[model samples]
Target: MADEGTSTKPVRPSMGSMRSSSFLQDHQQYRPPNKPENHYGIDTVVEDIQASQISSPRQISPFNGIPSSENPPKIVESGVTHEFSHPNCTPAPGSRTDRLVATLFYRSSAPRISNAIPSPQRVPSPPRAPHSPKISALDADIPPTMAPSSSLETFPLEPPSSEPEPLDHLYGSHISPMCITSFLHLMSTFPLPPNSPSPTSAHRCLKLSAAHENHPEVVELTLSPAPSADYLSLADLRKHELIYRFEQEWNVDVALRADTLWRRYPRLVVFDMDSTLITQEVIDLLAATITDPPDLAARVADITHRAMLGELEFDSAFRERVKLLTGLSGEIFTQLRQVLEVTNGVRPLLRALKKLGVKTAVLSGGFLPLTSWLAGELGIDYAHANEVVIDEATGRLTGEVKGRIVGKERKKELLLEIAEKEGIDLQQVVAVGDGANDLLMMEAAGLGVAWNAKPRVQMEAGARLNGESLLDLLHLFGFTEEEIQQLVA
Candidate 1:
């Protein structure tokens, strides 16, 4: 009787239903579109076109419990006249037919989606492809802007494309066709930066040909067809890949000589006795040694200053300065030599050049007595300075110079003559000095380096080494770091 009562009562369906009526009832539940068992119709919402323009195809995947018998992707071909053919698309609740049709309108006649024509859209658009296009020799001739024809031969692996490729696939993204053509035209003018290097030079080339300010470590190698046989400046050569750029600070492009310029120059370099070898106004130094006439010394010094700066003619300036010191003593040479200070970097540079077999020479406009003493001290090889005309009886200045002045033209003639006598080519010569008088000598040599020179000399000379020690000339000669080490050691 108790078991029968428990089963028969139906339990009055209970207070649980009263407390959770909405959760148990199916009235407010959502039924999924194609799955009757799944009460919620969460996937039944229709997707409306945001804009009336054609858009890229959307790929759809099946929702769980939706029948796989239905094909979600409806592929419509361009110009082939596709008909709505979804076999399982039943009519929506309000529609008489199952087809959700979209009318095909002509681009010229249809209302545009926006002010600008969005790039052409197609059904079943392709996924993104690789960066560089694989172009065959035949395909290279084909215009990049044209669509690949609907033939299997066009894109070998891709089957005869059922519809024409979206114009975006043939051309590129939303950019105008005219803009693309302009871009290609511009690219044709200059070679692309990436392909500028030579293949063979790139392989074995450990060194770069040029220097760029931004990339201090990496050498820049610019390769083009070898230049035609014609003369060109360094700038011209750089334009045509004939010369490479070197660091301005490091190489100091003053002169380019034969490979052995350091080896064959003057063994005995002779500088002028006055301003050539020493800073003391030579005539003034002579005056200082002879008498304590500071005023006459200052006047002679001013004349030399004008001459060195190219203000006065060399002959006129020489005559005036010499006339001022007409009656000095021969003993002045000894005093001047003792007091003279050699120019900076002379010792160090001479030592470096001596190691490389360059003997120093000093040709001077001043008296020989002081120069000869300097020759022995600095190990100079040759000394060609003026001889003071002394009274043979008294050993006093006779108010006259003994030899021809070592002026501009004479200096040049002497440089070439000395080069020939030393068995060195003129091209292997390196001249260094700091005056307008030195300009002719500098031009006569292979590498004329103006050392802390006046502006006029620097402008006329081949290379100028200003505000730097003379030892910097070693770098100009292409000395390797290791070679410099051995030389210095």
Candidate 2:
């Protein structure tokens, strides 16, 4: 594969019926004391009462819904707002007296004003009536220093926008909006475990920060509330839970992980062969070569499943299964490789990875003859597995491992060896496997992806891809749709 690693506020409570008697009583509580220093030339409260009392039955004020008393300095009469008969009411619009009284009026009348304009968390958060008025009050309280001379008319009272705080969990590396959002909604439906909920200010928020998030090829985003500990980090547990959802509900055939960085660029990729790289288990196929005990094939297949499930140890299972093939013909090895079905999307993925110059390897617990052959066919750079001994003269299976069995531990060692030889850090290596034995190496790599792995492995791997095609792996590395096409093409 020519795939190169690619890149990836709460508001205050509203003052309900702000002009209600309760509010006025509270306002009087905090209002400037009636001391000499508090006595300004104009008294808005007294003037408001006087204006209401003086109004005649037939008199129609220019300010219809706006009460004359609510006007701080003077009320508009006959459309002559410019003429103030009282010398004390001639202060400029931004005067402290004007600001103080007008600001109070602006806030107290929110129930009426907000009904005219609904302010949702204008950007990401939904607008709730309880918080909407509080937002307006904040807007009205412009710092006097930041206000202009005609602050009443030119004040920056437009609601200051608040952004979604990124969830502690950050996600990136996706193909499109539909690809990412559907995946997210599916995972979010997963029931969170009983972590004693720690009430924090940053719940239900998110941020989009990927350089190419909206690009047809890549999507990036940051969400909050991730697990802090690295050991069985909440990430791994979530992956386990996500795997359950993938298999059960929602025909979603893909796995989407929320990670700020799944090691943005991986220099090498390693895979396990049996159920991962190919569809048929080589051992089960080899067992089929035996015609005796009619149920021999069935027995070997069961053992293989248990071994992969981690119920039976790999070495013992491999030996027990191989012993059953004591007299198999050598020619079948070549024949087995011929009929091996590559998992969906493997060809294009390998071709893309090769083009990107990422080293690829196969670390198998199966026989080496088929392992190496598969690696060569797929253009993989390295191969390691157990080699079975055969009788030279008869050209048939001897049913014995020639060297140290390349079991779970050996697979991990080989992975580290390959990465070390290439001068790459473990973080730049990706391990893909689907068996209990694959867990060690998967844990050892920077990003361990469970490719349709067993339950145990799925529960522990760093990331899991539930899709049928490995081609989506390209998307995992943050490749754009166009770039993937060019590489595969």
Candidate 3:
């Protein structure tokens, strides 16, 4: 059962390497007292924002996978009792700096176990097949994520839309007549790798309200695996092939998921801050302050890229990078705020979620200073990120991080904690990120969208949206162009 020279030693976390009374006091809510099995935990938020001494420690899952009973998470509710005094910096004035911490509390997540790598399909893709018989709203034999087809609710079942969603974000009113073509045969011949027989069927109801007469429109697809198949595994494989076939080949974006009513209505959407919400990686930005060592910023950014690709363990990489920023003034974070640029389509996306009564949060692995600032500007309700130790008198960083670093496992825990408090089911939540660590939480959500992610992440994530604007995510939620206009209005 063991390989030669393989060791089973538990590597201590880099976050634990820093020793200081201040860090210890600021980091207990995340540090659990004991490890237990099958127990659930919660991340409490003490809503007074100041980077004040109020933060709870978060846990990281040691192994890969979505959170389950096996790796039970534990959290301690250390009330808002302390204060972190750092000078404030605002990129755009009038942004709210409320408490946005997802004090995560979950055991390790369980990684997906695959029998084989998803094989590539035939070179020349199959021509678009004829549209299959659309499933009626009243049918019980529908996709895995939908409400049981057997339910007897008196309300009329809203059937899936057969039309394509508009791409208004890119094209204004110049109408292109040839963009909306049916692509249903792609899934009717489902479970793509190895050229296998269809073990499941998928469909979508697209009714976009926006106008992109000249641009490509989005379409939705729901999957239903046969009795003997593994729903999640099957869906993952199907998703991979759909993307492999269209995402790069013709520049057409794909969004696949288990067809469910929840897709039509989501209450909470969580985003990763650094690259997902903003264009700059905050850590690399901080690293730019280092001039003694030439090209330190580039070197750190490379490591950052590698870590996101799942090449290096994020925890260790985080420590190595943070260690390089030792002796830098805390004021640099404030000054760096001026250069932070929000990603394309973030403003409209957040505004749409808000108008539709959906809650949003930013669970960043980067430091708190920028995370809090971005959250304030976008009106995100909750934001959680690692805090850097600052000397109260000198206003400079000590090259030490306070509280636990929010790694893969930690991010998943934060997602679960937020869903539990909001009374939102895991299936109704959406997690979006572009890194290896984000995979854990992404897999945990009802829908995991890899937005212009690395090759590995794009393949492993639940679904992907490589569109020009983050606003395209609305289509995945089954929103029609008409509905999109009303929601963001």
Candidate 4:
């Protein structure tokens, strides 16, 4: 009894793995009609399959150790193989099954160049296809002649033969480059300077002559002078073989002429005023100077965008936008007219246009006061724009537009009017503008451009020029690098 005070109970082991005695006692919960205990039967499945059929390299569980009964692996023929566990995943018929099977067939079917005894040399075809019999007959056709196999051994050493061949015997079904070159050399007697502004004149004549010779479809040809040769006609030439090279020579000469003509031709140039000819949007600038309500500029801008994209009727959109600024004073127009900055390329492009006699004009939907001011500043011959109305009593904006709004249709009218007045065809006119209202005018011109236009405007325009400088406009007329540089200089 002396140590009884410190007596303690012994620690007990855990019984958490076993079911409670109460679980076995509750017969109704275990075997109730509505609720019953479930068994997965995983152990029963393992017991039914044969031991040898099972593959159990690693034990999965202590009490229910089992293995899967899948078939053993086998070697497949050469080709790609993709095995799937699902029966529905099999490949379709004719699909390569194994990599080895595919690789072997691929290598067997591949073409190989052999180095065994060399084969006899095959005759090369002439570069051109034969012309139709009727076409050849019309040109006083020359039959194709084959150069001897041995004769080709020394190229460039053979001197050029100078004899005109009948038009029909050229290499390709198309006009021969050789013939073009020869024809140009023959026509070199004409005053076509290599430095000529344009050879289109010479090209037209060559094209006409080629048409008469029965080669009717000659559109483009590039020619270079061949080794110097005496020019001789088909009847007078001693060497008949040179006729084989004549077609290609003719193509060369005609090409040179076409290029010369294209170069000499005059070009039509156009300009877009907002951020193109001029640095700022005239409408927005007008709005800002007039101190319009904040919402007024945004609404005008939205309508302007819709009009430019063709989403809204230009007249309606223009009227609606102008209505928003109904109370703005007219004096702001005078102020904007003074502060406007001509964009980088305006002066140069105008000078170049004037120097080249390019019909130059300003097509704007902005106010006429500013348009006229700019037209005079750059020396442009024509300017078209809307007219802002002012109340005589107040000298402030009557908040109304006067005359034609110069919306899309009006712009189109102005373009046609200018073109007609100048006695120039629509094809000779170029229209440039940034607004949606300018689209119709641009469309009527030979080249209609969206200059730094909104996204909606660019897609409708013939071309979109967003460059920082305007000289790039020269490129549209097909000016060469040298010519552009000379003009800029």
Q: What is the lDDT of candidate 1?
A: 0.50
Q: Which candidate gets the maximum lDDT versus the true structure? A: 3
Model 1 misplacement above 4 A? 1-277, 289-294, 480-482
Give each model's whole-structure lDDT: 0.50, 0.63, 0.64, 0.52
Rate residue 316 of model 4 by lDDT. 71
Q: State residue 127's C-alpha deviation in candidate 2, in Å.
A: 52
What is the Å distance of residue 305 in model 2 from its true position? 0.6
TM-score-best of 1 and 4: 1
- Model 4 CA deviation exceeding 4 Å by range: 1-272, 290-292
Highest TM-score against the true fold, candidate: 3
For model 4, the local distance difference test gives 0.52
Error of 4 at 179 (Å): 30
Task: For candidate 1, write residues 59-125 as lDDT tens digits.
Answer: 6544444333343434345546443443333434774321111001111111111112112222323
Tens-digit lDDT track of model 2 for 370-442: 9988888889999998888889999998888787898999888898889889999887888999999999998
TM-score of each: 0.48, 0.55, 0.58, 0.45
Report how far off residue 211 is in candidate 4 (Å).
Answer: 47
lDDT of 3 at 23: 39
Evaluate candidate 3 by giving its C-alpha RMSD to the native, one decimal: 35.3
Candidate 4's residue-wise lDDT over 1-489, tens digit each? 547678777888776766433433333343445532332134423543332234347543332323322442332335655333322223348742110000000011111221121112444333433322232222221222323234456334544343443343334333444444545454444333233222221221122122335442233323222112334321222123332243223322111111222233434444556656887777766665545366767767776666666788877776677777777777776677778888876787778777787777776777788888888888988877788788888877765778877767777887788777777777667777777777777778765766667766655665555545566565555544356566756
